[model samples]
Target: MARVKKPKAMNAQEKLTFLLSLVPFLIERERVSVAEVAEHFGVDAEQIREAVRLIAVSGVPGETSTYQYEDLFDIAWDDFEDNDQIVLTNQVALDDSPRFSAREAAALIAGLQYLSALPENADRTAVASLMTKLSRGASAQPSQLAVEDTGSDATLALIRQSVTAGTQLEFDYLGARGTRERRRVDPLRVESMDADWYLRGWDHLREAVRTFRLDRISNPRVSEQPISHSAGDVVLPDTLFESSAEDLVVTVEVTNSAAALLADYIPDGAAREQLEGRVRTTVRVSHYHGLKRLMAGMSGVATVVEPAEARRVVAEWAAAGAARYDGDAS
Candidate 1:
């Protein structure tokens, strides 16, 4: 005999959506037959019955796992079991969706604008409809939120089109050294962080998973050939801060406000509180040049806690800046 395959588990989002929808539907019907409701939702009768049972037992979770009876969902058990009809005695009000705050709505609008830059989002009608619906549903006005796209529109559009068609792309990428290199990449996805758009993809030339800043990429061409790599094989780091064995780990004592800029650079298990009411954060950097640039921007508020070399570099950089300022004053 063949073994029966178990159904795939519903994720937290799926379960939440189902429960929310079920409550509003049950409220509308007042007395819904279990079999009919199950059919409508494309679920088995047993599944619907189990869902109802779960709801009946659930309540507003307190500080502990326990819940009070008054807070629990009430169901007419006799009617449900005997007549196969669902009758809710009481339910929490969740029919109307929560409205987005002004900030939240603005964030969504900014994200949508970034997405709109993609050529794969070719259906202008659909995009406009989506934007209108989002703006209309939100508590804030879309006109109030201003989001700028800093990347090359033509290059980004081509990359998006290539990604959608599952094809490879070739582009001239300008490096930090101001030199341009030709690269062929299997496009995966485009992501935005702090308004900077980056394309995370498989670089066929280098044979590694690489991230290319959209602003640095130029003359992008979509290939006729299909993509030769699986997207699943590539995984990008949560933070784009480069990691290397040669990188120096420089610790700094910073105030709460001052530490925000170093959030992405600080490694795990490297942040600790000091007796002087400051956070000691260890950051990894390629060399003194980057650290000098960072410290110069901080205006002497950040103090290097360790590594003699880094300290020396910061002191020298500061002295040079002071000399430059004095010369300008003269």
Candidate 2:
């Protein structure tokens, strides 16, 4: 016969902490086996049984300095003695505990919905289960919330498939410089910021790690050539946009409300200044070719404050866009 090792003894403080935690655990599950609770807490089954005995007699003293029967915790004695199950029938002062508000639950549910959209989070069952629990547990009814599809599910699915298969991916990518080229890359990691999805991969053409926006990728095809490099094989930059000596440093002034939207564009320890309700900060980009689109996206909330060339590029691009609607009645 094999000898069973006893669990190490816990001191007074440890026992108190265990008892405090055990109350909520039993309350949440309504019923749990002593063996299961012991496994969860990493203790012996006998320890859990002892804690239950302690909890049943513990309670806050009444005004007369006496503990009333109703004021103390109570458990189902029949199940505990027969099946070794723990069930709390009478709880003390826990009904007054704070719970998630309707607004808070709605916000959390919205975030979970966004998480469910990612290709990596393919297990809809877990996310759905959590959302249901939040809805039911909230103090009030949470407002209905939904995440709109980004219309890049197909591209995201393909990239995820390539990454799992350790295969190289081929795609016609429209670069930030407004040039389109075919690229072959070893799929590495897929990430998202705000509403956009990006793929970080080892670019064979550039012989370096490059980040590609999912929306700009077209004609994606998975190649049979096995991935030659993984994320661990390369030193990826903390930021998606890798800085280079040739990167053009342009200063821009943006409204205070929209400054947070430029987090990825701003480099670490970059020069920044606040004047009234606007801020002036330096941002880096591969070239000024992409500056026009950035300025347009801000919709007059941002402006290139310096670098005669960058300002000229944006102005010229805007002028051309306006020319398209020249003399149009509609």
Candidate 3:
């Protein structure tokens, strides 16, 4: 291979990484603009094709494709100095999220390695096999998972340390009820439940063990706090995963205009039926805030049709709003 003048910046490996990460996305969209690739990846459209070209030829070669064969991709790149286009000859049924996230690759490998390290005596042979697939890219990568990185690493460090030490913790907690107050909590453990991190600890103010979202905590501090109480009393709900049994069950009767927006906002699982003009919809949400906000945003377009408490809550909130600004309550 001769010394090819590389693009202004980006090494072969970097380019390869960028290209592979994108193959899945382009594959999903099936075909995409060269401009989108350039704008998103911060690389030239030509460079992206160079990556696609690499993908086109990547696979085992064979008669059709045996062992070192690279003819699977029929990627055709069209160059227009003013506007460019790219076409994929094949489907992108592959996981490409890792290509976008270099750290995720390491996290991916580390997580697998951690689980794979479990002993055969642990009876996780099946799990071990799945972990291997994860490392090798069994499932496709997803779009970016939203993460709000708090400036303070101390909060994270505190939670991890408290779990390790089995010590209690103290912090001012903001409850899901939108009521803010201070509390001394017994840090039972921390868990990533439902894509959000939560402290599965004993919230003292509530006189009960409640899951507090890690992000909601402020001034998190680990204490020499002694607690003789076992976490046996702080049990998570058994119905936590039962979607059918434990959905919010919100019902909405809406007119034509609002009905269209309802489909975008409320999920089908929560929404019930669609008839000629109006639809009766229901949602099974663990909490009311999400549904409350949805109804609030819908304003006059839709009506909350079920659950007397839900109706009362919305009415109360509306009344509160009316009093706050001395606005029209009628």
Candidate 4:
């Protein structure tokens, strides 16, 4: 039989932190076995019991400067002492705290559903269970909510497999310069920005960390070559698109309400100014084609303001798109 290792003894600060966290856990479940709580916290049952005893006597003092019976935390003494079970008979201030509203619960459930659909999240039992728990714990019944899958399952699955096996991935990538090139990368992290999925990895061709949009990837395959670098080996930027000295600084004008949409493109400490009623901001892009695609999505709400090259690219892209429909109109 395998012997269980004992948990390290917690210091005074750690014990106090543990007790504070324990109250919420006990309140959420209403009742739980001492052994179960011990396992959840990876501590011995006796430690949990000691913590509970301390919590029972701990509470806010009344106007008289003495802790009253109602002011202190209370537990079902009979159940605790006899059955080795915990039940909070009385909670001091938490009872008056607000719970999640139906709308809030629905939004959270929707996010969990999105995570459940991701290829990286293989074990979805926890997510499904949490969704159910949120519904039961909400202030009111949440409305039905669903997230449409972006149809990148096959690509995402291959990427997940490569990352798990510590292998390299080879794919035909559509570059920001409108060029398709076969590239190999050591898969590191897969993340999402807005509705699009992106892969951040060490690109063998560039010999540096690069980000690739999933929509631009084609003919992806897991290579036999093992990954040369791991996430810990390199510094991954907090923002998806990390700006470099070589990046083009393009200025754009957008309405006040739509300015928030360019947050990812606008680097930290970048320039922003309010001109007339619109907000003008500078965004970094590796190539002009990337700006073209960005402006296409914003259409009437955004316009390229400077760097003549960026405006030219957007105008030519729009003109080319309009030209295609000209023949169809006849």
Local accuracy of candidate 1 as per-residue lDDT tens digits, 148-195: 544576777787788778899999998655779999999876776654
Per-residue lDDT over 243-288 for candidate 2, one digit per residue giving the tens place of the 0 to 100 score:
7898889999999999987887888899889988999999888888
* Top model number, lDDT: 4
Between candidates 2 and 4, name the one with more favorable TM-score. Answer: 2
TM-score, one value per model: 0.53, 0.65, 0.38, 0.59
Superior by TM-score: candidate 1 or candidate 4: 4
| lDDT accuracy of residue 2 in candidate 4 | 100
Query: Relative to the true structure, how large is the alpha-carbon lDDT of every model?
Result: 0.77, 0.85, 0.61, 0.88
Task: Give the lDDT of residue 260 in candidate 4.
Answer: 84
Q: In model 3, which range of ten residues has the least summed lDDT?
A: 113-122
In model 1, the Cα lDDT at residue 279 comes to: 79
Ranking by TM-score: 2, 4, 1, 3
Q: Select the stronger candidate by TM-score from 1 and 2.
A: 2
Candidate 4 residue pairs in clash (backbone atoms < 3 Å)? none
Using TM-score, give the best candidate's number. Answer: 2
Residue 316, candidate 3: C-alpha displacement in angstroms: 12
